[model samples]
Target: MPSQPTLAFNRDHIHPGDRLCVAISGGADSVALLLAIHAANTAPRESLGVGLSAAHVHHGIRPDTESDADLAFVEDLCIQFDIPLHIHRADIPARASQARETLEEAARTVRYDFFRSLIASGHADTILTAHTLDDQAETVLLKLLRGAWTEGLAAIHPIIHINTPNQRPGKILRPLLQTRRTEIEAYLHALNQPWRDDSTNADTTYTRNRVRHELLPQLRTFNPSIDQTLANLAELAREEESRWQAELSRVLPQLLLPGKPVRGGGRSVSTAPGHSSLSIEIERLRPLDPALRRRILRAAARQLGSRLSFDETSRLLALCGFLTLPTVAARTGASLHLANGLRADRSPREIRLYREKQSANPE
Candidate 1:
């Protein structure tokens, strides 16, 4: 396990002033993160300064007793640390019913929604989540199983800005992103901190749990460094993506139609009409590099109103051949659709991309 001071210094880099909210689910990883941050703040590290508060969201998805136990554990820890504790109870069942969503999605949405509310209420500028290296590996593996794109394989970010409407903008900081779960457990043990173990985490019904219990163990038979390999892949992917995004941002304006807004108002990108609508011109894409062209296509599609899968991206790239003909239309010969209202086009410069109008009350 890493020394507490080392971990504390890492947290100080992510969270400087004594003004951050630590999200604690009463799990070992979160508990350890909370304790580490707290210890660092109170430690005589003149260079590192920060104050920490505990934020707990009760999803109310599990049995009442289980939910109570998690909350009780966090409350006690906060009291022991003499830090402020915020508890938010969410009606998960009702939310699931209303949204017609699974319990997992509902609970996640509610938890973050409540966290955003805390930020809006001036609780903290940044919210800390305890996502360890194991979590990152699990996420990368999950995305790989589903045939993820390069960006998807980048895994969970150390810091992400939550951009939901009507909520105060805040960042989610993962100070423990590089720390392993084993190290977290060891730290908790050394501190004599007790945490609640969620039974759902062990349930094989979830893909992540199944991967953790079944697939990982099987893979370990051949390669003991499977997790490390996956983590390294994620880091490389992240670096590549950062460079790619910067280049795209620079080139996109020249490629897009005139007077288009690049961002804002729920629109990811916007372009004005020229010869043909910006949306139609996108259908004419062919000269751009196959890799970058697909990224731009996906981004445009997402802005329009749809998401493209990895397979869809491949199909879109194949459609570029149609630009040789006078007509700018291409078809996958399947029900699979590409983003931006594209069909079959035989010309690269003539194809345009269009933004789909958002439904007034999309489900």
Candidate 2:
């Protein structure tokens, strides 16, 4: 028998009176999480001092017979454990068509919307999803392949806070973030439990499927512990990202100024329809390290509801006249029109970023 997987819930995150909901999809990872949580709740010596609930979302992408069977299995499992279960049936294909999104994107949006509804309706205080170490590894590799930055390499986060329409705060927690998929399956097998396999997982057309099925196995030939190694990289990146965020918070206020610089005793605001504008003094920006400079430029764009890609950030930095060295003279009267109706302008003394009022584009 395989050694049972331990539930490593953070004591700081879970409270005695908290209502925790486990998102189960009849897959090995999710089924193992629900089982572990339920067992902890029932064990006299190991009780977590919290209520347990289960939720399942049936994405209507697979055949009805297959999807319906998964739902049935989840329902029976919940009933056997005497746990409250919530079920959501989503027409994912129709949703994808209507929203002009891929099936994967639509399914994720629908699933999160349902989870948020549960929290807003006071059904659960926290939602737990079983994202394992393997998932983190896959995410990190995908980000690397896409030329992602440090934040992207951070991959999956363990905790996410959601603000609901009803003014209540909800949390999404991943308790199994450090556990491996092999351990999860072993735990289920030890319990004589069977999980439904999603047939779509075999489709290599999806980038993640190819990574999981082909790339990871080949990588294992070179490094047997590649999964764990990648997961550790993500953890390290997350720590670095947290540190950078703190530094940005401390330094941004002094460097960033609001609106255009006053020229000849009159403010020269852009005629472009924009909600707000932000400026940073070139004198303050030029002396900083290149890393800090890029971060500040990205931060300023973010304040205007725009995200700067790596190339975009480099372009903005070049516009500020820091091509190869800080000693380069600052440029004046240069402006860049960016995606999502955001624009950046360089003046003699400052660089300004603003969002032109256009059709709302969510980040």
Candidate 3:
């Protein structure tokens, strides 16, 4: 059995006055999270003095009966715990057709949309997701298989602001991130709590299921502490990335044209004298750290409303060099095509980042 203190330590990270909406999927990990939160609130110390509620999003992808069964199970658990339950249902098929995307992507997008709606309607403040250590291990390995960069290797974060637009940004906290799947099962068994298992989880058709069933076991033969090691690596990467982001945020403004928009659709500098397009002095930027230069380029791309993929980053760097030499301009277009109405113009003294006017509605 896992130490009760470990559970308590996880719960302690959650503070009082935090309105947490627990994402309960009628799974053992979620059930354990719900019960553990209840236990912490009722403990003698009484650490959490805030509101607690259970929220479930029905994807409507599974059979009607099976989906209903999962919803009913979650409802019953919420009732047993004396917590208010908010159930939101979404039609995945309809949304997929409208969005022109795959079923998996559509379902994920719809579920998050529903979660944002809950926050918008004052249903909850923080969304507590039940992502265990096993899930983290699976994610890290999956990303590693795909040749992920530092950010991708970082995997799922313990806490991050939901990026859904037009909604009040609420926090998504993964309190169970450090806990293992087997430990959650043990906790549920000890409490005599029943959970509904999704049959699709056993289906090896899914990449995650294949990794969990086949790859992880083979790895455990060599190192039983595989999950812990991966989790540690994620934590370290997160810390490093956080520091890198902070430094980039501090240095980005000087590199940009005074009034140009920063990446991610916002002003470059809040307190700048004038609001105008951002002009990048490429010569001045060359002396700074290469990592900082890359971040600046990435930010510029985002300002144009386009996310830079790993390949895009390399292309942007190549473009920077191409701009320095006048001979290359006749062969390749002098400007780089960044998405979302943004482009970079390389001049002798500076690289100017500008946002273009578009008739179509911005996403």
Q: Which candidate wins on lDDT?
A: 2
Cα RMSDs, all models: 6.2, 3.5, 5.9
The predicted structure with the larger lDDT, 1 or 2, is 2
Q: How big is the RMSD of model 3?
A: 5.9
Q: After superposition, how far is residue 317 of candidate 3 from its true place, in Å?
A: 1.9
Write one digit per residue (lDDT tens) for candidate 1, span 137-222: 89899989988877889998877887545666778888887888888887777766778999889999988999999998888899
Candidate 3's C-alpha runs over 4 A off are 1-6, 44-47, 145-147, 162-169, 258-278, 322-345, 352-363
Off by over 4 Å in 1: 1-9, 163-169, 258-277, 280-286, 322-349, 355-363
Show how many residue pairs clash in every candidate, following the order shown.
Answer: 23, 0, 9
TM-score of model 2 (CA atoms)? 0.92
Ranking by lDDT: 2, 3, 1
lDDT of 2 by residue, 8-55 (tens): 544457777799999999999999899888877777785788989999
Residues 1-363 of candidate 3 have per-residue lDDT tens digits of 664432532664477887888888898888888888877777778547778998898878789899899999998888877999988888988888999986767977876777788787777778888999999999999888987767778998988786445667687888888888888887777766789998778978878889999999999999999989998888888888888888878877766666434458644554533222566656676677777777788776666466676665666666667223333351233666665556666655556565655556788
Query: How high is the CA lDDT of each candidate model?
Result: 0.72, 0.88, 0.76
- Distance from true location, Cα of 151 in model 3, Å: 3.0
